[model samples]
Target: MKKESRQKESLGRILKYMKKYWLFLGLSIALAVISVILTLYIPILTGDAIDYIVDKGKVDFTYITPILKKMVVVILITAAAQWIMNVCNNKMTYNIVRDIRKDAIRKIEILPLKYLDAHSYGEIVSRVIADVDQFADGLLMGFTQLFTGVVTIIGTLGFMLSVNVKITAVVVFLTPLSFVVAGFIAKKTFSMFKLQSETRGEQTALIDEMIGNQKIVQAFSHEDEALESFDEINERLEKYSLRALFFSSITNPSTRFINALVYAGVGVFGAVSAIHGGISVGQLSCFLSYANQYTKPFNEISGVVTELQNALACAARVFELIDEEAQVPDAEDAVVLEEVKGDVDLEHVYFSYEPGQKLIEDFNLHVNPGERVAIVGPTGCGKTTLINLLMRFYDVNSGTIRVSGVPVKDMTRSSLRSSYGMVLQETWLKEGTIRENICMGKPDATDEEMMEAAKASHAHNFIKRLPKGYDTVIAEDGGNLSQGQKQLLCIARVMLCLPPMLILDEATSSIDTRTEMKIQEAFGRMMKGRTSFIVAHRLSTIEEADIILVMKDGHIIEQGNHEELLQKNGFYAALYNSQFAQS
Candidate 1:
């Protein structure tokens, strides 16, 4: 029952998308009606021409010629109407698909970061691209075949009833059987097709994961395991796909079998009626054509049912994505922060990715304006989680985080986040020229300003050596550039913006020591008057921080200037000594 409801809801939403193209839809329907009517009239003209032939010698060419000419004109008009109807259908189907894609992309943009963090990138891509393509195929088939099939069925039934009530009754009687068989098979196939779509998404995700990290798989000698996992997913996808197709394929043949019965019933009864002088031989010929036409739609409709099932399944998945809860909108009175003074405060904060995990609890911090604070902690100690909360990527479960003395929640997320310049360990660079990448945070930045930021981040030298200098177009995710170069570009991006506050989370992890030192100097200059939060594992890199925060298991174990913490010989001293000892 729930599955049926969901299918109806998905179909309803698709219709809503089509509502904007009602004029085109109406035109297509009108054309389909004209085409079917003209097509049905052709059989009558054919029967008339047949009656005109009497014993072959008494045939009247003048009368028969006009009927034949009328049939030709009807066929031509039918063909033209069908062609025009198809054009409208194609336009509407593609336009709806385009709108669906656009909505999916817009939803992705506003979706909470937590949602993205939980879902695999490849699965999302499949929903937006592969599933949508499948939906388009189904919609197009429905528009082209289903509409005409329905009109043909109704038109043929009316024509048959006018000629002979008994014959038309036989066709209607057998017609219900076709619907019964199709409905039974369709109910079974919907679940199979839904499973098939889900499994296909899993396979796509697995393949994407393996291909994107092939270097790691080879380095770890895990090719056999990767292939094994992929084979498992591939086999499941094949199983579901085959099962779905098998059930859907049954609908067509089963309906065809019932339709043949209807056709046979008409032939047997119409012949008897003619032998009894109840109808002329020409009328029997016309009735036979109407019977074939009436049953043909049943067969076509069954095929359409199969396609619509698959399309509905894909559409359900896409709508599920679009319907996901978006990030809470900024309050109506939310104020945009301007002229940020860089004072940050976190009071009694608590957060966890999952409930009952209690990752971070009662965390408190206060930074004076323009202070440089560094955070050092072991893995899984909520170091990165802290940055996530500060940037509003994930809201704290309890308590408040304030920037410049205003609660973060009270400020527009865009305005609050725009105040911070972040350079993280995992650098992300879109496929674009070096100049475009560096100027991403400030698209309209002057060339001199961009070059200065690049030189400050020690990326200018490398940029100048590139084949196209700053115009060098990198591959997606900066795949063509070395990790260090990508990191430098990310730093240059932050430098170009020069936000009032900074978050440097292992910002130089990818760079060599020499370049790291130069970047550190650049960072020192940039951090001079900005409130900066630095999260790093290397204790040596943050020794000059105005304050060093030692964290453990989501608690602030110690907090003081580097010298003060070193003198106290607490967790901070132990972490610092361990790093240098390892070196």
Candidate 2:
């Protein structure tokens, strides 16, 4: 129910964009009314000609020519008016759809990082594409049909009553009876349609998951299993689609039958009234024409209503995404971090992904300006969590983290992030030239400056070896490059940013030892006069760090330079000897 209301709110919001085209809307309705009124004249002309022939012995141009000429005029006017309506309606639809898509995309951009982390990628994709499509049909197209249909129905019914009041009663009497059937079938069809959409969303999600993990599927030879799972989702979607189709099919035929019965009654009554001399030939003709206008509008309206329900379901999903709170709403008074000195401090910081399990408990660390710190621990000892907190990716639950002297939460996210350069254990490279990837770190950096940063990270030599050097094309995720090469490129990229602080999380773990030595030397150059945090399991990598902190199960158990930790014979020493310092 909340989802439904959200979708409705989205629809209402869309109207504001549409409200700009109010003139077009009014013009389209005006044209449709004129076209419908002109069309109603056709049936009147048909019946009037018949009545004239029956009342007189001979037919002459005087009696028939005027009606024929009037019909030609009506046809030309209707054709012109219809062309105008189609043009205006189409223009209106385009503008509305464009704005809606833009709003959805723009909102997605400001959505918090946590929201993106929480939701499945496939579900997000579906909301943007599949859900917005619903509003395209019902909200926009339905708006078009509704305005035109109401105008036509009203014009037709009014003409009918003015022509012969008594006969018009019979035609309208049948309308109320059809409503009962329309209401029942609309309810059933909507339920089935909703089921179909749910299944399709599931199927989309399954396919997205399978494709994203295609490497695992091929490695484990589980392609067939994946295919079977996909088929199950497909089958459910098909079943629901078929059920909706059946119920929707009931609506049109049922309306057609009701229309047929009403037409027959109107014809019989007209004949009897005319024969008794109570009505004229032209009068009955006009009455039937008016009745036709009413029935015709409803004839198509029933189908449109079913489609509206389907669109409504889609709208619900889209609004659900747009309504999600932003990932990081900026503080009203967030100060820009002009130039941070990279003095970082953490005090009594505690955090947990869930309530009961703390990932970091009372974690405290201080890195003065230009100091170099290395954090080492077991895999789950909150190594990465510390980095994440420092980056302000997640705010602490019970403590304060400061950059310089200000709490991180008080700084705008963009400003806080701009002060640090980070190279993760895993690296990513967009499919582009090496130069483009590096320059992305500092969009406005000079070419000489970028190359200098790359040189400092030891990436310049490898880049020079490529055929086109910096222009060499990398495959998606830089798959063509070795893991170490990608890591080196990421290193160069972050280094180019020249941020006040640098974080190298297992930065050298993937490279060959020989390359690690060269990169380490280059990293020493990169870290000069910059506060740096290095997280590594390799004890040899951190021996030169000014401060070495050892963590275990969310607590900082040991802190000192490497030589000091080795002397303590605690967790850090045991870990180093067992993994690195032993052999």
Candidate 3:
């Protein structure tokens, strides 16, 4: 029941977009009605033409020609009306899909980091592109079939009843048996299709992972293993897809068989009625035509039901993404933080990515405005998690993180995030000109301001060497640039932001020591008045920090300046000595 409700809800959301083009859709529906009405006349006219031929007992052109001409006119008008309706349907369907795609893109922008992390890039991409495309095609087919089918069925039945009620009753009784078969098969197929959609998502994710990490796969000599893994996922997808298609395919034939039974029954019953003078031969002919027309729509609907099932499955996947519980809603009265003073305080903070698996517990910290703090830790020691909390990427499970004396939770996310500039170890650069990537943090930045930022980050020289300098379009994710160069561009982005607070996560790890010193010197200048949190593995990088935090597990085991921590000869001392001790 819940699954059915969700499907209905997904359909409702799709129809909401259709409401925008209601005028066109209504016109399409109106045209379909007219076309079906005109079509229904053809059977009646055909029957009349048959009767006229019988009455003449010879080929009398005078009587037959008029009825034949009327038939031709009706056929032509119905064809024309159907053509117009199709044009309207295509326009409305395409436009609706376009709008749906736009919404999916926008939803990706607002989705939380956790959601992005949980789902594979391939899975998300599949939902946005492939699934949506399938949904659009299915919706279009389903709409056309549904509208025409229902109209024809109703109109055909009404005409049949008029010709002879008894024959129409036989159709009504048998037609429902077709529906029962269709409904049972449809019920069986729905679960299969849903499983297929999920398997497809997993398969897509596997493909993306393999393709993106092809180098690693080759380096590890895991080609056969990768193929085996992919084959496993592919096999599952194939299994479910085949099952869904098999069951769905049964619907049309089963329904058609039932329709054939109705046709045969109509033939026998109508012949007996006509022989007994209960109905004329003309009425019998009309009833046969109406029976075909009536059942024809049922067959079309049965076919469309399969398509609709697929569409609903795809749509369910899409809605699952769009309906993801949005980032815990910001406090209603969340205030904007302007001209941030950069004082940061973490009071007995507790956090965990997963419940009962606490990564940070009873964490407390305080920093005066404009202080430079270096956080050093072993891998998975909550170093980056601290930054995530400070930046409000993930809220602390308990306790408060305050910036400039205001709880981070009390501030709007945009305003809070805008107050801080961040540069991470893994640099991200979109497909755009070098200048645009640097200016992304401040889109309205002047060329001079941008160039100054590039120079400060020591990225100016290499950028100047590029064929188009700052105007050079970087390939997607800066694939055209070296790792160090990409890091430099990311630094330049943070430099351009000039936020009052900075979070540098292995900010210079990619750079050579010499270039690192140059950028560090520039960072020294930039850090003068800004509250800076530097996360680094290299002990050499944090020597100048005003405060050094040595973290182990989830707790701050030591806090002091580099010189003081050295004297303590504890965890920080062992950590610092180990790096140079090997050399």
Candidate 4:
């Protein structure tokens, strides 16, 4: 019972995509109407042929040839009209589907980091590609076939009834029988298609996961386990696909049997009436032709419904993504910032990802214009959380965050983000040359400026040693470079932009001693005349910071300059001792 309700809901959702292309849809229906009405003329002409010869006992090549030629003309015109309508429908539907797919992607792309965190990577990927594809393609083909089929069926039946009520009765009786058989087929087929859709999403995700984490899988000796998981998803997809095929196979044969029964029944009834001389040979001939022609629309429809259903299922998944509310939205009339001086204020900011369990409580901090500060903490200490809130990844539940005395929310997000230069611990790079990745940080960077940024970041030497210098192609995720080289390139990339504020969140923590000296020299050159936040393990980097913050469990445990914090001697002292001991 619930299943049937869900099926209707799925269809309604699928129909929603067609609203935009409804004008072309109307043209398709109008064409179907013309075609159906014209089809009835052929059967009527069959009656006329018999009447002109057998009933009147007269034959003339002159009249018969013209009548037959006219039928051919009508057939050709109607066929041409239907073809044109179908072609327009196809073109319009494809555009609508493409636009719908693009919008769904746009929605997914702008979604907040938290939303991505909530869903599996595989599930999100499937929803974007396979599911969206199905929705658009299904909407086009299903509506086109179903709507045209109905028009032909209704028109054919009306003309059949107008000619002889008894013959119309004979044909209409098969309607319920055809529907019942088609209903059984539809139910079985829908279930298989649904299973197939789900299986395909899982398979796509599984393959992506295995390939993405091949290193870990191999290290853990999980190759056989991974293969087994993939095989399981593949097997399920094949199983459901075969079931849909089996049910669909039965539809044509069932419709054929019902059609045969109707024909035979009409023949037997018409023969009895003619034997009594109650019905003429012309009327019988026309009535028989009408019966055959009437079933034309039904045959076309029943065959396409199975296919249409599968497409509808795919569309259902797609619209679901489109309808989802984005995690963030800017005000309609928000304004962009102009010439930010990087004065930041975090005032009594209380926040949590989950309700009633606060990760940050009454957190307050203020940095004057062009002031450089270093923030340090243990893992899960809200060090990154402070940066995240500053970035507006999540909004504070209470209090306010301001940039240059302007509320972050009031300023347009794009303008607000453009004010900062951030370099993180994990320096993620694309598959590109040294200049390409550097250029990405500032697209308008001049050649001299680009090289200067590289020189300051200490990435110039290694780049020059490579085969093509700055033009060398780095492998995926910068695999061709050493860890230190990758970090240096990322720093150069960030330095290329030279925004008013800079953030280095453990950016040089993973490098060896030699690279560390080079990175420190680069950092010195990059830090001039800008407010920067340095999240680092190397205490020397923080020694020159105007203010130092020690964060733990979402609160600032201690705050001072490097010398003042050392004199206090608590968590900061222990960390300092450990660092020197390791050295």
Top candidate on lDDT is: 1
lDDT tens per residue, model 4, 1-583: 8656767876776457667778887888888778777877887876777677843556866778888998999999889977987886787778777787788889887787778777678877887787767665665666567777787678777877777788789889877788888877887877788778888888888888898789899999999999999898888888988887888788888887887888888888898878898678888888788777667556666777777778766766666777788866888877688888788999999988889877999999999877778998888888887888887878888989999898998888878778888888877888877788988868888999999988887788888999999999988778769877888888888888888888889888767777787777777767777888888777877888888998888999899998888899888877877788767
TM-score to true structure, per model: 0.97, 0.90, 0.93, 0.86
> Where does model 1 exceed 4 Å of error?
56-59
| Global lDDT of each candidate | 0.92, 0.82, 0.89, 0.81
Task: Estimate the Cα RMSD of every predicted model relative to the unseen true structure.
Answer: 1.5, 3.1, 2.5, 3.8
- Per residue, candidate 2 scores C-alpha lDDT tens digits across 1-583 of 6644644665576677779999988898888888878887787787777666754567766888888888898899989988888888888877877776777898888886667777778878877777667657665567667767778778777777767888888988888867787778877776677677777777777788888778889999999988899888888888899999988888889988887788888889998999999788777776666666677666677777777777767765666666777666779999899989889999999998678976888888888999999998888989898888998887788899999999998889898888889998888889888888988868898889888987887788888999999889887788678888899889888878878999999988779999899889988888999999999988888899999988889998899998899899988888888876436
Pairs that collide, model 2: 111-327, 112-326, 112-327
lDDT of 2: 0.82
Q: Name the candidate, 1 or 2, with the larger lDDT value.
A: 1
Best by TM-score: 1
Model 1 / residue 345 / CA error / Å: 0.5
lDDT of 1 at 286: 95
Task: Give the distance in Å from residue 34's predicted Cα in candidate 2 to where it truly belongs.
Answer: 2.9
| lDDT by residue for model 3 (241-262), tens | 8999899888888988998999
- Once fitted onto the true fold, the runs of candidate 4 whose alpha carbons sit more than 4 angstroms away are 1-17, 43-64, 183-192, 235-253, 271-289, 332-335, 427-437, 459-489, 509-513, 538-543
Q: After superposing candidate 3, which stretches have Cα over 4 Å from the reference?
A: 1-21, 52-58, 64-69, 94-107, 270-285
Off by over 4 Å in 2: 1-17, 45-59, 62-69, 278-289, 431-435, 455-476, 479-485, 581-583
Better of 1 and 4 by TM-score: 1
The candidate 1 region of ten consecutive residues with least summed lDDT is: 574-583
RMSD of 4: 3.8
